[model samples]
Target: MKQFPFFIILLFISSCQYFEKQIPSEKELLQKELKSINWKEVDEFPSVVDCEKVNDKKLRQQCFFEVMAQLIQEKLDIDTLSILYPELDTIEVKVTIFPNSSMKFEPQFSKDSVAYDTIKIDSILQARLVDFPKVNPAIKRGVPVKTQLILPIIIKAKEEKK
Candidate 1:
């Protein structure tokens, strides 16, 4: 009968570890969670000055794209877009917005693969890009991240009669 009491005590002591709290500290916990987060996707995408005001997630994304397109078009100086010839219906300007807010400009034709004035286009784009403002980078757990943006500029010579 005495052995029953000792055996119960032994069992209780052996299982005591299971009841102990193993909770990590706040910093440790955050570090652990950060490690598991997928770097490919972010909580918030990169945004410009105007797009930052939007509250909705999906709407913010759309605003970001729209604002970027508008800004690029404005910077292109459509008034003098056709210095060589003013007969073309539209001029396609492809620009890449880097994470650091730097731009890569590629002016090319949509259908016809013709040689372009790379130097002039690069200079114009460089000046415009420098004049433009930097954008807020994408965020993953509040950390800023790099992103890519492509903008296409099309110039129409005249409106078609409808």
Candidate 2:
């Protein structure tokens, strides 16, 4: 019977520690507040790229591929496209449109070394489109708003020498 009270006290101490660690820091609290703002509200559709609304899904997919191609070309600026690996040389970029009037972009590569090499040269862009800039205000939305986007770029790395 005496051990019962000690067990309860131990439980209380452990629970108290857990709650203490869960307390949000000031920065986290502020970020949550900022994210809660009504940034997705829109009176009209956005006017970024030229396309018909009837084929939004199809057109968006094509547009994303086009954008990816453009970014790839930009990356290869002033450089000749060598036959690095005819069988393995390839890149893919994906753009995801969100229901919340936002978009996300991602790039994936078949070769893991390509991803690693990209990070080594430009650590900021392992799966990121360093060429694409932030969407301009005019192209973002018809109404004043804020949105978050993610873009990824994948590149094929050359085989290393022994």
Candidate 3:
């Protein structure tokens, strides 16, 4: 029987390492680049008229909020409400802007004092919002997104001391 040299066998075994393949196990497939993400926050906030020109994100947000507050303050008949409901000094409205440019509002007044009828306030709010111009909605990943804004309005009586 012909005998093979042990050195030649070692050299052949070493050369086989070049063809060795790396087969990833199930762990590689199960591992994720990102385990979680924040979907609630939008990349851009809803912009009001004339606020689109602002480029800085923080400034844009500020302008948006300012414009919205101004619009609501100008449009709503808060003075009348203050005169009618002397007890309620503050009110909160939860406004939501949808991607379709439509808005939804939920008015919240002080329930303990019961100064004014909420139904009447709700109706007045709805009518006032009708005059508000449709605004550009928030954006997320280059897509328009729905956003919510809480507006707190303080209505003081005309005779009350500051």
Q: Please write out the lDDT profile of model 3 over residues 30-127, one tens digit for every residue.
A: 46422343577888899876888999999999988778777776666444777777776667888899998888888866547464688988887787
**Candidates in descending lDDT order:** 3, 1, 2
TM-score of each: 0.61, 0.31, 0.71
Error of 2 at 83 (Å): 8.9
Best by lDDT: 3
Query: After TM-score superposition, what is the CA distance of residue 31 in candidate 3 from its true location, in Å?
Result: 11
Tens-place lDDT per residue, model 1, 7-63, is 999999999999997888999999998899897787998777888778998999888
Better of 2 and 3 by TM-score: 3
Q: Against the correct fold, how does model 1 do in TM-score?
A: 0.61
> Residue 140 CA error for candidate 2 (Å)?
16
All candidates in order of TM-score, best leading:
3, 1, 2
lDDT value for candidate 2? 0.46
Runs with alpha carbons beyond 4 Å of true place in candidate 2: 1-47, 52-57, 78-88, 94-107, 111-118, 121-162
Give residue 129's lDDT in candidate 1 (0 to 100): 50
> What tens digits encode model 2's per-residue C-alpha lDDT throughout 20-51?
76778999998998787655543332223433
Q: For candidate 2, what's the RMSD?
A: 15.2
In model 2, state the lDDT of residue 136: 28
Which pairs clash in the backbone of model 2? 105-150
Higher-ranked by lDDT: 1 or 2: 1
Q: What residue pairs clash in candidate 3, if any at all?
A: none
